[model samples]
Target: MNLLFSNDKRGDYPQSWYAASADLLAPFAPLGGVQRADVCVVGGGYTGLSAALHLAEAGLDVVLLEAHRVGFGASGRNGGQLGSGQRLDQLKLEKMLGAEDARRMWEFGEEAKALVRGLVERHGIDCHLRDGVGWAGSSAGSVAELHDYAAHMDARYGYGLEVLDREAFAALCRSPDFQGGVLDMGAAHLHPLRLALGLAEACVRAGVRIYERSHVHHIQHGSKVVVQTDAGRVEADHLILGCNGYLGGLDRKVAARVMPINNFIVATEPLGDRAAEVLTRDVALCDDRFVVNYWKLSDDKRLLFGGGESYGYRFPSDIRAVVRKPLAQIYPHLADVKLEYAWGGTLAITMKRLPHLARVAPNVLSASGYSGHGVGNAVQAGKLMAEAVRGQASGFDAFAALPTPAFPGGAGLRTPLLALAMSWFALRDKLGL
Candidate 1:
């Protein structure tokens, strides 16, 4: 089944809290007849919008196509946590890619966060950008590991983090379940949908043509690539696949490495007088679990809690119930609060939890599989892809050199196999392993 159309209505945004509050732009008409550009970007989320904006600013004729509205996918529906490092931890990356490359990767990750901040400031995009992200630990061992990692980051990378004991953590989070935590001042959170829509507005201002509700049917590869849509086609000197989890059968090589998965989130009704009881500060919190529970207070004093995962193609029917279990586990006092919104979105995951950036052809590039850390990395990937199209490919090449193995059993059986594996992991998480 096509992920883009399977779980959501065509050309319509999901009934998410993000959508409810966003200042959405007028819809861009679908592509018609024929079109040509110096670069054709498929997907209108962070990656594609950023790429199109940068490419157009460089004086390249750019066109970006989205099957739905901008930010209608995971970009708008995610937990909105802009994490500090790559998906994998530094020590693990050092072991996998060695010290020198790992150091470079760390710099890239820092640059990713800086890029997001700079873009927001330069473009005047007001998305309630706020600093501080706390990592809450589940067990004593996990707490100790997080404390050590915070020290490692400080000593090795000069990144400061405030380590919190159980008492201090509870004071801030008001959750007795957390053993300890660490707060990273460098990381931040924002209104994800507003950030995306702002970027789309900036892209349009920079002369990038955006087409919504234009689904790509196929791509004919050649020196000048031809991207086919239902009502029209785009012939371009360069093609970029930023479709992420919504990318169907556009490119077989990319499909093999980037697997789509569903994740859900729910928002509580506005808790005016009791907002401080849930979160003392307006910072985001994420726990150490295989299936993590992340939450933060919205600007309107509502708790935006994101949790639960479904291995299948579709989301659970009762998304609120799926998320409420974890929400209550952390904040039992707010267990019976009214849920105003519950929604799900698709995201791409890889075996190694690292992003996959590849040059499918000399003129065709693809980047996805950011795991859960796409807020920063995805935007950086877009800029790097734009650089590659502009004849400076060192950055893109560095990311492309990373390993991205295909899932076993190919396309048909990989989902079921992953489901079985995830069930075991979920059990381990439940058992406190």
Candidate 2:
């Protein structure tokens, strides 16, 4: 089944805490007739919105189409952590691409964070943005690895992160399971949906024509690309594909290299003063599990936790129950805590875990496979694509330089193989291997 229409309504946002909390904009009219622009942006998540905003600010005619409301996908429904580096960390980059190129990649990570912060400030997007994301570990060995990684970043890249000892970490994260961790004050977290809506508003103010519920089904690529939706069509000098997990078969090359996966998150009932029992400080905590458990406290003092084990084509019947298993693992005291909202989202991942940025055609550019590091990377990818369209491609080139391989089993077999692999990783995580 087509993922876009598989599990959700055509033009509605998911029933997420974000959708409930965000002050959404009125729906933009769907595209109905032939349209032409300097740039055509498909998918209205961070990447498409950012690209449209940047291109429009530069005086280009831009049109953005979204099958659902803007930010209706993973952009609005993720863990909301603005991570420090790419999905693959710096040390791995050093080995894979050499020190010089790795350093450039590090700088790109810095730029990515800066761009998010800058946009929030410049556009006055009240996303509840805050600093300090903790990397907590359950075991002593895992904690040691965190400390070493922090020191390596500080000494080699001058990243200056705070290394917390067991007691010190316990002061920040009241969870008894965490022995120690590294706190990156440079990293931040916020309301993801608010950031996306803010970017969409910025795009409108910059003169972009945004058409909601405009599902693109086909394309005719040439000197000038033609993007066809059911109701209308767009012919533009350049095309930007930011569909991420929802891209489906629109482009087979992207579908080959970028595999889509679903993730779930849940928000607990307002904890009142008991929020301190979960997090002593207002920092986000992410564990070192292969499946990765992440959480933060919402402004209303609700525990927003993300983790689970559902590896099927469709989201599990009960998302809250799926995430509750891991949520209890981290905070057993709150095992039966009331979940106020629960939702699932899909995002793409590549073989190397780095984002896939490519010029599928000379005039058609695509970016996906953020691998859960999409907050900063997606925004940066959009800016890079915008710059590339204007003849400045160095920023985009850095990401495009990384290797992304096609799934070994192709479309049909990749999901089952991944499910088997994930089961193995989950077992290892449980055994603390």
Question: What would the TM-score be for candidate 2 when compared with the true structure?
Answer: 0.99
Q: Which tens-of-lDDT digit does each residue in 246-309 have in candidate 2?
A: 9988899999999889999999999998899899888898999999999999999999999974
Q: Write the per-residue lDDT of candidate 1 for residues 1-433, one digit (tens) a residue.
A: 7788888899989998899988988999999989999999999999999899989999999999999999989999999988887989898999999989998999999999999999999999989999989999989999999999989888988889999999989889988789998998889999999999999999999999999999998999999999999999999999999989988899999999999999999999999988887989889999999888899999999999999898767788899999999899889999779999999999999989899999999999999998999999999999999999999999999999998899998999999999998888889988889
List lDDT for all candidates, in order: 0.92, 0.92
State the displacement of the C-alpha of residue 129, model 2, in Å, after optimal TM-score superposition: 0.3
TM-score of each: 0.99, 0.99
Q: Per-residue lDDT for 61 in model 1? A: 97
Model 1 lowest lDDT segment of ten: 308-317
